[model samples]
Target: MLSTIVLAFQRWDGLSARRFTGLDNFAFLVKDPTFWQSLENTVVLFLMSTVPTLVLALILAVMLQSAVRFTNVYRIAYFIPNVTSLVAMAIFFSSIFSTNFGLVNAALRSLGIPQQDWLGQPWGIKIAISTMIVWQWVGYNTLIYLAGLQAIPKDQYEAAKVDGAGVVRTFFSITLPQLRPVVLFTVIMSTIGGLQTFTEPQVMVGNSGGTGQSGMTVVLFFYRAAFLDNDYGYAAAIALSIFALVLLFTAINWRIFRGRSEDR
Candidate 1:
């Protein structure tokens, strides 16, 4: 941590002598268009993945909680993706989203939809990376939600059932309200994970972030600067910016959830 802060002020290209540049790196960062673009892409990917991931995870958790047959098998199945190697997952998704001769395009063709390039376009790149992130993390989150569901008092559900409440009604009135804290935890954790996204995009699109840098993320941007470009000082500054962004978003999440609780 201290080294990063020091490096942020000193310019060094790994093999060269360290020269103190003070805020020069930061100033250049302010004027760097790619940095801003990467920031925007990061946020876009974060929202693209995090929202659907949590929603699907919560729904899966609810279903799993009610399962009576092959319960352990189902739980293991859902969690398999989380434990699988990320590189392998990225490669697998890359094949799935390939522009030509891919299952996704094939499926679209079968459904009478026009086949679209999944990795060659800007939006498609973001979607592909976000989908990979969701697939990787959703199972872990589902298990978290399942644990929270299990911890809820059985009496609350029994009372709702006795009152002739339907599954949908009970889920909203009883289940959701009780899971507020768990939901908040998941949201914050997702925010952190989303902002730090690196491997999927790097693997899927390469270090250049693909055409027009649409797939560039903050961490990937930093990695490119530090390693590929040998701009370690600038990379350090970028790292600090990433930290600040994560902190800001986390605080926002905390406040939003805390306010809801107070309102209740």
Candidate 2:
């Protein structure tokens, strides 16, 4: 596997490998407007999806931890999406976001609101893609958080109750602090997943990310460079750049969470 990969880099003629132009591809990527646009879109989607997903997952996990009825059934339902095929989900979402006769538009029309061309507009396409990502991953995160919540000793909550701490107070002061490591883990995982988002956007908005390339994630951009445009060297550089970005963002998340825990 390593030899095949190295040979692709060493002898690949598709990207003018005969002349080793060190950093040329990297320089082009730095100045590429499309690359920057994709980066911006990626960040926006990450923020939009990760924040809400984590918040909702935390809430759901808390509810489930309270000896709720049918807890096992709920767990299975939430985890179904994680086990389901992403490609199939993407395809399903694409049909739902169609400009005409889509479920969203039909519902809007029933409410006397104007229908939207979801996949035809840049921001709309982004929202659609982000929605899919959130829907699919929120359940998985919830399960992880639920596990973390279950691990917390019952004595802590019992003691908090005896000390006259309200439910919210105990949650904020006790539950949240204990879940810091789990939260950090989810954040880092989401960061890595968000940075490499490709299929939903690609399948939903097509190759160029619909209007103005709004839904074009960095991964899609890399795919285009390497496969569609046949620029192997540039694509490899973009891949490395993505790796660097993921590392940077993961480090930032870890530092922020670690600092917040220590501050408390």
Candidate 3:
């Protein structure tokens, strides 16, 4: 990390002698439109994937918790994607969302809808990447939420039942409140994962971030700068910036969840 910080201020192509450039790299970064674009795409993808994943995971966890048979089987099935190789999954999703002769477009056509190019448009690219992220992580998050649900004391549910609480009421009042810490854990993990996303977009859309650069993410941007452009200094700067951004966001998450816990 220290090496990266020092490198951020120096210009060095991997093969050339190092020259100190001070903040020149950062100065250029401020004027670079692509940097801003990549940041926006990262946040957009984060929101697009994390929100749906969490909501779906919670719903699935609740349902799984209520199941009386084959609980382990259901849990294992949901978790399979999380352990699967991401590059392979990304390639699979690429085919699924392919512009023509893809399952998604074929299904849409069967419903009398025109086939939309999934990778040829900006929003489509972002959507495809986000969908891949959600698919890969939702099951992992489901298992996390399931673990939290299982850890809840039975007395709480018994008490809620004794009070004539409906399922929804009990869930919102007892289950959710008790699971706050677990939710916080998942939120922070998801945020970090979202910010550092690389493999999915790289595999699905390539290092250039696909058409219109819509799938560009912060980490991918840094990777391109370092490996492709060979601008080690600028790449180091981007990497440090990403680290700071992740730290800032993680602190924000801690404060928000901690504040809520205090209030309750």
Candidate 4:
């Protein structure tokens, strides 16, 4: 591992290896418009997935925890997508978002709306990627939340009920507070996953990341620069940038969750 790390920093046979560039590679990355664009795209996709995914997962977990009939069946159904092949799922999404024969376009046309060119537009590609992320991860998050919910003692709910607290009040006062650690775990994991998202977009939009490179995440950009374009120095710099971004976001999330825990 140490040798590999050293090798990454020192390019042996390339033009970049002739002399140490210090922080020049990083500086070039900052100046690159595509790098900035890819960063922006990653942030947008993260927002599109993280918020709704957590919210829906929490709701599903709570519902599943209740003694509803067929709860096991529901859990199995929700988790199926998470275990499915990502490439196959991406292909399925591609068909659903197809401009002409896609289910989405077909629905739009039926509603008297013009068919959208989903893969050919920037926001559209981001939305499509977001949809895939949400679909793929919501189940896993739901299971995490369900486990957290199960861990909460039943006596607490009984006590709240005896104190004349309604279900909503008890949920807000007891359930949510108790779930903080689980929520923090999910948020941190999601931050790491969101920052490194590549497969769905790559499969759905191909290696170039679709029209205008809207679907080109930081990792995808790094892959293209390093492997496809053979610019290892710049790719290493991009990799470090991605690492920094993930660290920054994860730290922010930890701070936020830590504060909430302290307040509780």
- Clashing residue pairs in all predictions, respectively, total 0, 0, 0, 0
lDDT of 1 by residue, 169-250 (tens): 9999999999999999999999999999999999999999988999999999999999999999999999999999999999
lDDT of each: 0.95, 0.86, 0.94, 0.89
lDDT by residue (tens digit), candidate 2, 1-264 = 343234334324474535466556767888999999999999998998888889999998888877558999999999998888888998898888777878998899999999999988888888888889889998999999999998989999999999999988999889999998999999999999988999988888778877999998899998998789877767777787798899999999989998987887
Shift of residue 134 alpha carbon in model 4, Å:
0.3
Q: Against the correct fold, how does model 1 do in TM-score?
A: 0.97
- Scored by lDDT, model 2 comes in at 0.86
- Lowest-lDDT window of 10 residues in candidate 3? 126-135
**1-264 per-residue lDDT for model 3 (tens digits):** 999999999999999999999999999998999999999999999999999999999999999988999999998899899999998999999999998878999999999999999988999998898998898889999999999999999999999999999999999999999999999999999999999999998999899899989999999999999999999999999999899889998999999999989998
Ranking by TM-score: 3, 1, 2, 4
lDDT for predicted candidate 4 compared with the true structure: 0.89
Name the 10 consecutive residues with the lowest summed lDDT in model 2: 2-11
- Best TM-score among the predictions, by candidate number: 3
| N/CA/C clash count, model 2 | 0
